[model samples]
Target: MTEKDIILTSEGREELEKELSNLINVIRPQVIEELVEARAQGDLSENADYDAARNRQAEVEARIKEIETMLSKAKIIEDSNNLNKEIKVGTTVTFQNLKTKKEMTVKIVGVIEADPFESKISNESPLAKAMLGKSTNDTCEVRELKEPYKILIKDIK
Candidate 1:
């Protein structure tokens, strides 16, 4: 794996840790049991159950490794230095659409934790990119979008 930092929210890190624990504790044991049961069924040649069990095992192991690596280099987004309420990772901001005058609030998060349905947008997103480092009442245009748009930062926390 590349030696670069993996940005993550605290909640994201906790979720990953929970997933790793589940894989190691519960899924790993179940896969081992499946392998044992499949092996007891006789010939290794053309054993569908055994093949499926092996595949599942491989997937589980790969995910565990991935999560481990991510957690190892994870950099949790910190809001401690954000006394001015500047838009940045881990900060929630309310912005108004310049054209429509529609208002919405969203929390900026890392790519791994971004969930639009939950109002958590990635820092690399066009809107977040345009708003980052800007303060309340700041107006910025997101030109990277297909239909470029502007937003007025109403509030940041």
Candidate 2:
């Protein structure tokens, strides 16, 4: 079966590659050493160290596979020069909440790079979806909310 393409920024791709490298080059070797040391302790049935090492090996291997799969299917979102004209992935958007009269800024990024706490939202998110392709001063509705809220696009950069 084919996996869906994972959208990622260059930084997000780098982070995944770094994690995969660490798992393959460092964590895998360390876990192998742990397993070797555990095996030297004799009977595996009553050995807590042996069980722990085995568990760690399984987890590391699983993660390595997962990362490899993701990397294989990753589609990197490249930076665009038209960011100043319209909202798009990698663009920092400033908007105003019509109801609450609050102004906020958020960076639209691929799912892999999104961090809500840092005001970085994924393009797949409701707000970002509504705002995508809109230019400055355009109004958009947040459909995900129970009571739809209108947001005025203030700037795009």
Candidate 3:
């Protein structure tokens, strides 16, 4: 069996590395201290702090393993932002809805780094799917649950 490769931008890889460092250096020590403190409290049978500390330890260790696995299989995508070039992961795209006439800018990123609140959209997203491989001034149609909408790419950087 083989693990699927995780596509990530350079920025995404950096973020994951930073998080892993924090987990291992800071949070892991804190969890150990919490467990030690909880164990020091008398009866293990009725100790809520012990149970909570154990749970937190388990969660933190699991996350550490997950991050390590992702990093092991990660493929970093380097962005080449040639003007009007094809859009892809790590590209910031600006497009206008033909119907609503609203212009929006979004950064295309990997699944792990996608944050709609930050205008970073996942490459798997319908809008990003339609826009990838297309260049500026190209029109693409995005299908959603409600209805399909057409967008004209205004810029790619």
Tens digits of per-residue lDDT for model 1, 5-43? 888988898899999999999999999999999999999
Error of 1 at 103 (Å): 1.6
- Superposed model 3: Cα runs more than 4 Å off: none
In model 1, which regions exceed 4 Å deviation?
none
| Top TM-score hit | 3
Question: Which ten residues in a row are the worst by lDDT in model 3?
Answer: 75-84
Pairs of residues clashing in candidate 1:
none
Worst lDDT 10-window in candidate 2: 77-86
Better of 2 and 3 by TM-score: 3
Highest lDDT scorer? 3
The lowest-lDDT stretch of 10 consecutive residues in candidate 1 is 78-87
For model 2, residues 1-157, the per-residue Cα lDDT tens digits are 2567988877788989999999999999999999999999999999999999999999999999988888899888776777358888888899999999999999998887899999999999999999999999999999885778999999888
Candidate 2 residue 53 C-alpha distance from true site, Å: 1.1
- Candidate 3 local Cα displacement, residue 81, angstroms: 4.0
Each prediction's TM-score against the native? 0.93, 0.91, 0.94
